[model samples]
Target: MSRRDSLPPLNPTRAFEATGRLLSVSKAADELCVTPAAVSRQVRALETFLGVSLFERIRGGLELTPAGARYLSDLMPLFSALRESTEGVMAGAPGRSNVLRIRSPATFAVRWLIPRLASFHRLHQDIDVQLTTGSAPLDFRREDIDAGIQLGDGDWPETHSQRLIPNELIPVAAPSRARRKGWKLERETLLHSLARPEDWTLWLKFAGFSTANTNRGMRYETSLLAYQAAVEGHGVAIAQKALVLKELEEGSLVAPFDMTLDRGGHTYYFAWPSHRPESKSLKAFRQWLAKVVR
Candidate 1:
């Protein structure tokens, strides 16, 4: 018989390893989720196969023999290594194609990251980035998504989060017809976004316009649409500073007021599951984002 065939079976070996190391059949049984009698049977089978005494009967329960102690010391590392190797293989099962799957909000994906993707692609040609859009709660267990960009207070449980940017609201309007500083507020038509309907209210209250009707504006489904409307000389839109930075810089839209509403506890974050071991590709992508954010 070959050496592999001559050795005791894995189940019996595991049984004996736990039984001998623990010195209590019931405790080992609890650990193994089997009956104490079943553990004893397996330990006996292992001893019979090896033709050696692995454990000895005691007054209270059992004790490991010197040989059993030595065997357990040798087997523990091997079992641990086997488990770790198996988990390591499974941890990276989703990265077989070297694709970095990222979930993000549609407006942020389009307005911010998409513009900077060309540089990311140029720098990391080997790492393919796949972007999915949704602002819903993130689930890292999904095979299609590895990580996500979230806008909130960064208090999500079971997640490792890195704050990318803070939420700052500023009033912006088209350069062509937007009223300059000190213009009458009642004269301008305020644009609104359904996504952030309270943005105008929040900013208005901060600016001491307590009596203004915040809900009375031409509402759009997204902030990007409102920003576009603002760019078309329609009216002022409460714009997120980061999203409208390019427009502000290029003189397409101008912040008519100097007051920017920076509410604490609201920030943009990139996050992934805390429990899952981060794959190398995901780590690289996260580091790249951290750099971009910096």
Candidate 2:
């Protein structure tokens, strides 16, 4: 290729990068300060320029194609470097104090974090925590978020992670449902979350039960939805113990069996890019999280 033909159009390249990283045209557009249609057009332009399909439309959202993933892996570092260089030049600019941006799983944020966040606010009145909900893999360089809460072993590459909470799984049902005659795991309707389809199987195995069939159930788009179904006495649902504490404590939901599955290596973690210097807000947040989790 000639020197003039080496690089793709900057706008299309940016649109594709953002879309590929975020996996949503609307989200990419929001980040780019453009319309969703514009983002879509730019992505198409880039795809046409490269002569390859970069994304596949999935049921609920977009999924990167194998080629797209590989391409994104290569493009991310370049974009990160560019952004870092730009920020370096713009350093010392006036900025807000102690404003922290955080991304977390929707259910966790709603059920656990938000409830306890007021305590953190009272403790560090100077700090402002802006929480966003998402369960996608974190790319600190690509995303504007300062920190993210992830459910994993804290092994994400180039991320500094601190364990936040143990992920314990237990089968729970509405009080009425649990007390109903003929209610048993082997017979009651099993509620499943599409996000964690294997949860039931994992819990069942740990509870010394056969993992033969966990597929027959009413599947919801999220754990929150499945838990709601359980709360309505629709079916028995496997729940992350931390996310349903209020329900359990308030007697809205009850665990019939005496078994709890500590989901091995998987746990909630507070993570951020290791390369970035830790800010006062981050330190305060981390310490507050530690105190609360304990």
Candidate 3:
């Protein structure tokens, strides 16, 4: 066989790269947007081609053998260089220059990012940002997204998370409702978001209040809906301060409590794949986010 015939197939190499980098087949599957079984099959194929055990099971988790680790080390720079070359070519193509595709959580997009986006456009008119809303994990290989605004402690696997906003929790209510009912926590109905059920409990604990009544409240499918309910005077809602800043300033929502719960580590961040080259559009957007959040 020719020397080229001995090389592993491209799919198996990619599968091995992802699995070896993350050290978890399931996580690698998530990043690749494939099933665990498929990832496992490709990994096995690569192992057979290499004629060496790539990973070993220890305590029901994956651990890379010495051979696998060495092989992965050699592959990392090659993959990185490949990514850079592809990005460079695509960037120079006509009509694609300075265009950025990004993802963000729906609530944060609507409440915070979208509202501030006009300023960014005014500052950097050359860059085009196409924003989509979702909290799903980012997969640069499987998706066309350039970056995402995620809520986390910047610990995402194979992702670089730049913190944008600190998540501080506070209870908010309509001004009329607070005025009429005095906004007492024990007397008022607690509005809750199905997405963040622990916000109220967390805030209550921070404020030295019992969490006994946190479960008794109206629930909405999302934090945005809960905020709307609070605006309409239905009930008091726990809000991340950053999301409610405009409403608070506009007098649509009133925070009766003096206390705020700073969610440790979990904050709004601008995240992108760690392995990919940062595009011009992404750099402009990241700079704008930092400036606005300041």
Highest lDDT against the true fold, candidate: 2
Ranking by TM-score: 2, 3, 1
Model 1 segments beyond 4 Å from truth?
1-97, 141-143, 180-183
Tell me how candidate 1 scores on lDDT: 0.79
Q: What's the C-alpha lDDT at position 264 in model 1?
A: 73
Stretch of 10 with least lDDT, candidate 1: 137-146
lDDT of 3 at 76: 71
lDDT of 3: 0.83
Count clashing residue pairs per candidate.
Answer: 0, 0, 0
Off by over 4 Å in 2: 1-29, 32-96
lDDT of 1 by residue, 84-120 (tens): 4554565557654356778888788888989988988
Assess each prediction's global lDDT (C-alpha) against the native. 0.79, 0.85, 0.83
lDDT of 2 by residue, 151-178 (tens): 8899999899998878899999999989
TM-score (all chains, Cα) for each model? 0.65, 0.74, 0.68
User: For candidate 1, what is the total of clashing residue pairs?
Assistant: 0
Which residue pairs overlap in candidate 3's backbone? Answer: none
Ranking by lDDT: 2, 3, 1
Q: Which ten residues in a row have the lowest lDDT in candidate 2?
A: 88-97
For TM-score, candidate 1 versus 3, the one ahead is 3
Candidate no. 1 TM-score: 0.65
